[model samples]
Target: MTTPDAPRHSRPISFAIFLAIAGAVGWWAAFNLTVSKIEVLENPSVDLACDFSVLVQCGTNLTAWQGAVFGFPNPLLGMGGFVAPIAVGVGLLAGARFARWFWIAFNVGIVGAFAFVIWLISQSLYSLGTLCPWCMVVWVATIPLFWVVTTRNLVEGVLGSSLVGFGAALRSWVVPITIVSYAVVVLLAQLQLNALARL
Candidate 1:
């Protein structure tokens, strides 16, 4: 019989699949914006952000060397790398149970993508001196998606609940703490960046 204290199992694979889909959409938008900029640059046209000046200018940000950090269009990387995991995620969500190793591997990929998003934001703020609005959209979308995917993995025991401890330590403290901590950190970082901009 299932005990009252039995852990509630969620579909981590399904959450991962959803994140992958959202990431793919973000990547597509970014790619289209990049391509549009290229066309405009090659033959000059009404500026993309004519109404907005400075940091909000898409044309200014897109034309920067840092925008093509790979020495080619950066969106290509997003298109190729970001979409594959979503496809894998969809397979898993379809009830194709993955091995523990596969789940862990995908989790690592999500962490890597999270790190890369932070790096890109830093580049835009400090190095590029301009922001790609679509890229910011990707950043915002990625944060919650990562949190949900990671939380689902933890709750479902795919990452070993013991790694975060067990019992009340797992359910009550760790999960809530993680969620709140992430939200706080993201908020602080955004505020700090905005503060710096004013100085």
Candidate 2:
């Protein structure tokens, strides 16, 4: 049985740093999307600042039904959702640790975000036939953020059973796994969307 006096596995400072980095990127993406949305509302035909080319276009995605899945722009969700991580990161940096339930809730949010981004990536590749730069930025940050946070959760035993030795093993491989996943997505985009050629 775990003893109450036993030292808990506290999150490292680097975790907070990475979280802050991800939050900043997410915030930037959300802010720009909000701007693009406003522009669209102001002038239905207004050319978005992020509308770079036919391939890398936010206008197309913004106009898509998938853009406003909840009857509001998706970025609005980001604007609010990303605040939690930022706050949490700041708290961690200040030496505050959360309860098991809090970590579980945070992980759940990241999992949901990861799933949504995956769907967005698929739509951008197959259905939309377009990629938004801002959305892509969110995807980039979300991937690593989810990776690190999920791995941390497993290692810290926040989810049900404590992983024990498995957590350390997973942590060691997390970066490589995240990198491979990112490469696969980029490669797929290059093959299907000609992302490299567009660049």
Candidate 3:
């Protein structure tokens, strides 16, 4: 499951870099999805560019009951929320270290994001019977962002000074863990949707 080591000459891929990349990608996807949602809102019958296939389309999800869970397009939250990680990552790269309270707050937001994405995943897999590609991008970005930040906090002694072995393992096992997690999702999607056959 381990892929490869990061470039040696380059600075090691820190949690901050992961945060920045994930945030940027997630924000971009959310922005696109939001625009697609608007397009659908203007004309529900119109086809979206992201509507690639019946099972891999965003249009179905955009109109789903869970899509507007808070009475507005969910991407609005992503658009706003993703900026924080990018900012924090930039700050870190610029040599800014955050206080414990800030880390705590940031982690709380990440946990919320993780929970919300899980709900969307279940909804997409079980209820909607379709996929939102951009949303999937967000989900892919969000999961590792959550784990990387959390494990970094643990490894860096940001959260606590205990469980050194556990922290080390989490940090070392990132690639494999992500591979396994992604495999599980892919397997579940294939199982529930028979995703490839429908294509």
Candidate 4:
């Protein structure tokens, strides 16, 4: 058990920094892809399809109506959503002592972004039948970011002593169990999709 006075694990801040960097990179790549798509629309010679090979094609997923979820290039959303958190993480890493309430609010936003990423992944897998490589990067970065942020809050006693105890209990059981279960579900869903694609 961690002593009450012990410094919390530094992994959360570190992971947050790593994720922010990754997110920034992902956003940049997505933005470039979006620009490329616009160029393709302007010129017929450019094939927008992401399928450079049997396994990859941006146009296959991106040219579809779903790609413009809001009827515009979706990367703009990523650009705006990702940059602020990265800035916040960088500031925090630089020794900014954000108030507990600020951290809590940050966590809430992370949760929302995580959920949206998952939804987008599902849409790509099932509806688009192709994946944007940059989008996958965002999805991967989000998982660790969410986990680290939540774990940090728990370890740092940001949620209060009682909630910290509850979080510790949940971490020992619920967290791992939920992660494994979700992994299994995702794997099974992918297998099913692959099977259907073969048929």
Highest TM-score model number? 2
> What tens-digit string does per-residue lDDT give for candidate 4 at 70-123?
888676777777776687768767656678898788789778877877777777
What tens-digit string does per-residue lDDT give for candidate 1 at 19-100?
A: 6677677677667766756766686766664216565556655666766777876666666766755676676676566777
**lDDT per residue (tens digit) for residues 87-167 in model 3:** 998877776777888987898899899999999998999999887899999999888888888887787677788955577
* Count of clashes in candidate 3: 0
> After best superposition, candidate 1 residue 158: deviation in angstroms?
3.7
Better of 2 and 4 by lDDT: 2
**TM-score of decoy 1:** 0.68
> Which residues of candidate 2, in runs, are more than 4 Å off?
1-11
As for TM-score, the candidate ahead, 1 or 4, is 4
lDDT of each: 0.64, 0.88, 0.86, 0.67
Order by lDDT, highest first: 2, 3, 4, 1
TM-score, prediction 3: 0.90
- The clash count for each model shown is 0, 0, 0, 7
Model 4 clash pairs are: 48-59, 49-59, 50-57, 50-58, 50-59, 51-56, 51-57
Candidate ordering by TM-score (highest first): 2, 3, 4, 1
- What is the Å distance of residue 73 in model 4 from its true position? 2.1
Error at 141, model 1, angstroms: 2.1
Best by lDDT: 2
Which candidate would rank higher by lDDT, 2 or 3? 2
